[model samples]
Target: MAFEYAPAPESRSVVDIRESYGLFIDGEFADGAGGRIKTVNPATEEVLSEVVEADAADVDRAVAAARRAYDRVWGPMPGRERAKYLYRIARIVQERARELAVLESIDNGKPIRESRDVDVPLVAAHFFYYAGWADKLGYAGFGPDPKPVGVAGQVIPWNFPLLMLAWKIAPALACGNTVVLKPAETTPLTALAFAEICQQAELPAGVVNIVTGAGETGRLLVEHPGVDKVAFTGSTEVGKQIARSVAGTRKRVTLELGGKAANIVFDDAPIDQAVEGIVNGIFFNQGHVCCAGSRLLVQESIADDLLAALKRRMSLLRVGDPLDKNTDVGAINSAAQLERVRQLSELGTSEGAERWSAPCELPERGFWFAPTIFTGVSQAHRIAREEIFGPVLSVLTFRTPAEAVEKANNTPYGLSAGIWTEKGSRILAIADKLRAGVVWANTFNKFDPASPFGGYKESGYGREGGRHGLEAYLAK
Candidate 1:
C-alpha cells in the first residue's frame, strides 16, 4: 500500500488579487485601448482577474515610454547609479517573496513549493546577480564603457512568469536599457505585481514598463519602430515569426524558444538517482519548461531495471491542486495547453508506444495531467520528435554511448540534455558529443542566475542568464 498524504494547502490570503488591472506604461497603470481578457486559475478554472489586452496603440505607447526613459534618464545614468536601483528592486523582491510566490502559484497552476522555492528565489537572484554587473561592465570582458542598446521590447511566456520577466528585464535595466515587457495573456498577474515592486523601489518612470496581452499585442510590441532590441521567450513558431519580422530592421533580437531535450542513462548509472533526475526533468512545472528532458534514452542492458524503478517512482508522484505542498504535478496552465498535451499523448499511444501513467486521481474541476511515460518509443514517433510541452516522457533504448548521442542529437532542438553515469570519463566524452547548449551529468532542471542559459539551432539563440545575458542589451 502506498503512503497517503493529507491535504496541506497553502493559504492564498497572502496575495491581494485585484478584480481588474490596467497597463503599466511610463511607470503608471493606465487604461488600455484594447479590450480586457479574464485570467483564470487553471487549478480550479476560477476566474482570477481580468487584465488589459494591449492593442497596437498601447504597444506604441509602451515602446515610446521606454525610448523616452532610455534617452532622457536611464541611458545617461552612470552604471554605478543604475546599480543602486537594481539592488533596491532585488531587495523588494526578496521582501515580498512569499506574496509573489503565492500569487505565482495561483496564477500559473504550478505547485506553491516551486513558486516559493525555485521561481521567486531565482527571480530575485537574477536581479541581484545583474545588479553586481551594472557598475562592473568594464571588467566583464565586454570592452571598456559598453553602451546601452536603447529601448528593449520583451515578451515572456506563461510557464515561469516572474522568472522570465526577471530574465528579460533585469539585464536590460542593469545594462542601462529601458524595457517594455509583455507578460503572457494567461499569467499576467505576477508581472503586474512586479510592476508594483518597481514602484516600491522608486524605479524611474519609463525605465521599466509592462504591457500585458496576447499574441497580437506581442507582435505589435516586437515590430514597433521605437524599440532597438527585442527579446522573446516562447514557441519556436513565434520565435521564427519574430525573426522574420525583424529581418530587415535594425533591432537586435534574442529568442529563447522550444526544445525536445533528451535524458540519456548509461548501463552503469545509479538507477535511483537517475530516476529522480528523470522525474525532475520532465515533470517539473508540469513539463511546461521549454528545456524539459522529454526523451529518456536508456542503455539497452539496464533499460528494464531503470523502467521498473522509474514507474515505481512515478506512481508515488502526487498530482492535483497547485496550492498543495505535497503535490508533485499541478494543473496545466490553460485549457488550450491541456488539450495540446492530450492530443500529443493520444498520438503517442496510437503510434504504437506503450503508455504508463502514474496512479493518481486528478481533480474533477481543474486542468490536470498525471505523470506519464511511454515505453517502446522510437525516434520516428511524433512524441519522440515533437515537443509535447507536458508531463509525458518517451523512453527509448540505446545499445552504446555513440548511439545515445546520435539519438539525442537527432532532434532539431539543441536546448538541453542530461547524461547519467558513475564514470567521469564517459560523462565527459558523451557530453562532448552532445549537440545541446546545456549538458548536465547526473542531474536535470538545475538553474543558477550566475550561469548562462540558452540554446542552439531551432531551440533559439543567445544567452539569458549570467555575464553573457548583458550582451543582449549592450551595444556591440
Candidate 2:
C-alpha cells in the first residue's frame, strides 16, 4: 500500500467572512445597483459569501469617486505622505497575514501552504517594495519626476486574488494614481477583505475602489470615459477586447495575459533537480499561473531517463483539501475552469498524445482534476499550442538545440519559458533565442517584486513589476 499522510488542515478561525459583501467604493462597503453573486469555495462547493455585482451604474460611481480622490486628495498628496500610507498598508497586511492567507485559499482553491508562503507574503512584499519607490521617483529611471495618470481601472482574475490586487494597486498608488478595481466573481472575498485593510491603514477615500462581478463589470469599468488608465490580468481573449476598446482613446493600458510556457530539459542537466523544477513549473498553484510552464520540452537524448524521473516524482503529489498543509495540489478554481481542462485534455488524447495522470482520490463535492501529463505530444497538437491553465503538462521531445528553440517560439504567447542545462553557454544561447519576457534557467516558478514580469507578442504587453511597472502609471 502507498503511504498515506494524516490530515493537517489549516484553521479557518483566523478569517471572519460575513454572510454578504458589497462593493468597496470610496473606502466604504456599499451595495451595488446590480444583483448579487455567490462566491463559492471551489474545494468544497461551499457558498463562502454573496458579493455585490457591479453594474454600469456602479462602475460609473467608482470611476467618479476615483476621479474625485485623484483631483482633490491622492494626486496632490506629497510623495512622502503616499509612501507612509503604503508602508502602513504593508505593515497591516503582514500583521493580518494569517487571516488573508486563509481567506485566499478558501476563495481561490489553492493549497494552504501556497496561500501562506507564496501568495500572501508576495502580496505584502509587493506593497513594501513599491512603497519605498513612492518618495524616490526621481531616481526610478522615469526621468526627474513622473506624475500619476488620472483614475486607473484595474480588473483581476481568480487565480491569485490578493497577489494580483497588490500587483495592480501598489504601483498605481506609488505613482500617485487613485484606482477603481474589480475582482473576479468566482473569488471576491479577499479583495473585499482588503477594503478593511485600506480602512486600517486609513487610506484616503476613493484612493482604491474594488467592485466585484464578472466580465460585464470589468467591461463597464474599462470602458468608462473617466478612467484614464486600465490595467488587467486575465485571459488573452479579454485582453484583446480591452486593447481594441482603448485603441482610439487616450487611456493607457497594460495587460498580463495567458501563457503556454515551455520547460526545456537537456541531457546533461542534473536529473533530480530538473524533475523537481518540472513539477514546480506546471504543478504549482494547481497550474493556475499565467506563466505556468505547461509545455515540457525534453532533449531526445535523455527523454526516456528524464520522463521516468518526472513520472515517478509526479506520483507522489498530494491532491484534495486546499486547507490541508500537506497538500501539493488542490481543486481547480471553478466548475467552468475544470470543464475547460477536461475538454483540452480530451482534445490532446484525440490528437494522438499519450495521457497520464497521478493517482489520487478527489473529493466528490468540489471541482477537481488530478495532475496530468501528455507524452508523444507534437507542436501540431492542440495541447502543445493552446494554454491549458491547469495542472496538465504536454511533453514534446526536441532532437537538437535549434529544434528546441523552434518549438518553444511557435506559440503566440511570449510570457515565460524555462531552460535546464549544465552548460552555461548553451543556457545563454537558448535563453537568447527564446522570445519570452521572463526566462528561468535551472529553476522555475520563481518571482520577486523587484523583478519585472509581463509578456511579449500576443501574450499581452506592458510590464507589471520592478522599475518598468512604475512607468505604467506615470506621464511620460
Give each model's clash number.
0, 0
Q: How many pairs in model 1 have backbone atoms within 3 A of each other, for residues 3 or more apart or on separate chains, i.e. clashes?
A: 0
- For 1-476, candidate 1 gives per-residue lDDT tens digits of 98888999989889999999999999999999999999999999999999999998898888888888888999999988999999999999999999999999999999999999999999989999999999999888888979999999999999999999999999999999999999999999999999999999999999999998899999999989898999999999999999999999999999999999999999888999999999999999999999999999999999999999999999899898889899888999999999999999999999999999998898899899888999999999999999999999999999978899999999999999999999999999999998888999999999999989999999999999999999988897
Model 1 / residue 210 / CA error / Å? 0.6
Write down the lDDT of every candidate, Cα atoms only.
0.94, 0.93
RMSD of 2: 0.9
Residue 371's C-alpha lDDT in candidate 1?
Answer: 88
- TM-score of candidate 2 against the unseen true structure: 0.99
Assess the local accuracy of residue 386 in candidate 1 as a C-alpha lDDT between 0 and 100: 94
Error of 2 at 165 (Å): 0.4
